[model samples]
Target: MIIKSPFTELANARQTPPSLVSEYDSCVDLIGCTSGQDGAHQAPGSQLAAKPHCMLALPGARNALTNAALAAYERYQMGQPDPRQLIDVLRFNVFYAFAHNAKVLGFNDDWLKYEAISPFGAPQPSPPSQPIAASCPANMKPTVLQMTVEHHPWIDFLPCPRMRDNFLRQVRDKGEDAVDEDGLCVDIVDAASARDPESVCLVTWGKPWVLSEWEVTEPFMKKWAWLLEGCTELMESTNTWRRKRGLHDIHFVH
Candidate 1:
């Protein structure tokens, strides 16, 4: 089955040069392909696309939700958990993408779960929810959709207990990369601050994912008047710089 993001036209690549998949961890790995942006190959199929893989909402990409769905399909074409098994997501915010992508991939309810997790400067997930797929209990809140990511899959909340305790703590640690002064959070977890941007990501969720700044915002730090007060921006850029270098974007689309 070929699940393509509603946007991005890497379908030609799969038939031509194909792409590469690197081991992301013991249970997961990274798949790379060409995209519309200045990135590598784009696997637009939602079923095949794991988080961190990104697709551009280029002029054609804005075709409602299907463009993102195409990105998921690219990932699906590569392969997945085979629907009858577990799809390991160590720190994935599996909300809108999981639900919509699961539906697209023919996944039933049992195939997904909101597993508990904890990573550095990140927070443990819910007893009832994680990101996209909601818990079964009737009392639980159902899933919601957003463009910005609360945490990249590389962000392991299981290691960072202290930061998850407070929303602000998460903001101070991990949310810096994604959050902006206008309250829009973009999920550009560059190498520098990628170590911990949990809170920052959450605050900026529900907005478009931007590489740097958009028409309404400037580079994240520039939007924050206090960036110069303590030079936290420069400090974080230095620390996070190395991590974003070889990084690739995965689309957990809807």
Candidate 2:
């Protein structure tokens, strides 16, 4: 689903507050560190050394490495493939690296396993076909929208009708110029506050996952901030085209 924002005007204004800009820069730096910048990966006899210019070439590399190491340790404890064996460690590291990288890049888990990681290891289990249910009971009627691309059909189930109504009201108040027939435009602040004071839920393909405010903002604070603006422009442009055809506006849950 297309994620649309009402703050496109402000973002387009290019008037970000100085303090927020500085904070975003700091977060980018932190992500760089985790990507092996600032000698963050230096260890006694460590063979991995990140190139200065390639700090973000492998985002989430450090965490992936750590997880690989832990998985090796677990295997050792279970008297399975021992980490003492170089081949075993290599296999574990390669698999975990692909797995974690896929997660960081927001790829489907099955896609990573079957298409990416499977070639390096034993066959993976088939992806599950069961639909996931929301943790909390859905308080609002599910709203289904047609997808532009071929994919599984899904519906948005908000926690309450007030949240849904508020979005509709915002669209009405904003009028046609702000309304996008491609998707519903929502205020980021309103969306975040609707979920909780400190958290929000992002649903993909009917699966709901809750993320804290920090989790939500961290991506935008890092090297991917420009993507948000790109999405904003895409929605606006597409909606403008769709509106000319007198199509009704669509909705998406972020």
Candidate 3:
């Protein structure tokens, strides 16, 4: 028995090209045509396509594209900068054009077979949590903080432990006067591992400062503000994984 496509009315209403609609129907039939004993729609094979592959197919593709378009529209409504909104809108247009091109080129069933055996096609396991100790002493001097970082056991938890050595070397080469006057210090690891800007006690011989204590005149801010912003973004993304494990929220002083 032949089944009527659910997309028929949608295709007619949207005036979608016949070729594209036919391609969509084929994809739906390939993946969602069969139902298992559990009443869940299963692909012909045991393997399900990775999330991205599924998202690019049939009804999933339509929903994903629509969401992308709506996000761009919402950005415009919110009065975001024109350039930023332009990027968002252009992203939608580019993906829409790519989808059209893919439809015209025809579908490849072999791609599914390849994806089924690929490691990337499976969901990745979460990285094991490596929490840093909360041992930052209050009112610690910058030099003492540096020393503590050099000898501290938690220093090993940094993504790049070599950064600690580099930081120490730079501070030593710059001399104490430069550190005091220019704030020539770096946050080696605590801001990332501890995931709290306030817990950042591992800094060079300069002003003992937290993220909240920003000074425009400070040389460190003038030179490394962008680096700090980048690190904050990384930490924020890491917080999602941390939250799943019921870990404390990563705090940024500012």
lDDT of 3 by residue, 1-254 (tens): 11112121122121221211112221111000111122121222233323212222244544554564465444434544232222222223323322322222232222122122111111342211222123432221123333432222221222222323434343355442222211121122111122122212221111111221111112222233322333453344334433432344443322
lDDT of each: 0.25, 0.25, 0.26
Worst 10 residues of 2 by lDDT: 25-34
Please provide, for model 1 over 143-188, each residue's C-alpha lDDT reduced to its tens digit, 9 standing for 90 to 100.
2211122433322211111111222332345553322311221233
RMSD per prediction, one decimal? 16.5, 20.4, 24.9
Runs of candidate 3 with Cα error greater than 4 angstroms are 1-65, 74-82, 108-254
Count of clashing residue pairs in every prediction: 67, 0, 0
Estimate the TM-score of every prediction.
0.22, 0.22, 0.18
Worst 10 residues of 3 by lDDT: 27-36
> Which residue pairs collide, candidate 2?
none
Candidate 2 per-residue C-alpha lDDT over 73-125 given as tens digits, one digit per residue, 9 for 90 to 100: 44544556331332222222223333333333234544321113211111332
The CA lDDT at 241 in model 1 is 24
How far is 143's C-alpha from truth in model 2 (Å)?
9.4
Candidate 2 wrongly placed segments (more than 4 Å):
1-109, 114-128, 134-147, 150-208, 216-222, 229-254
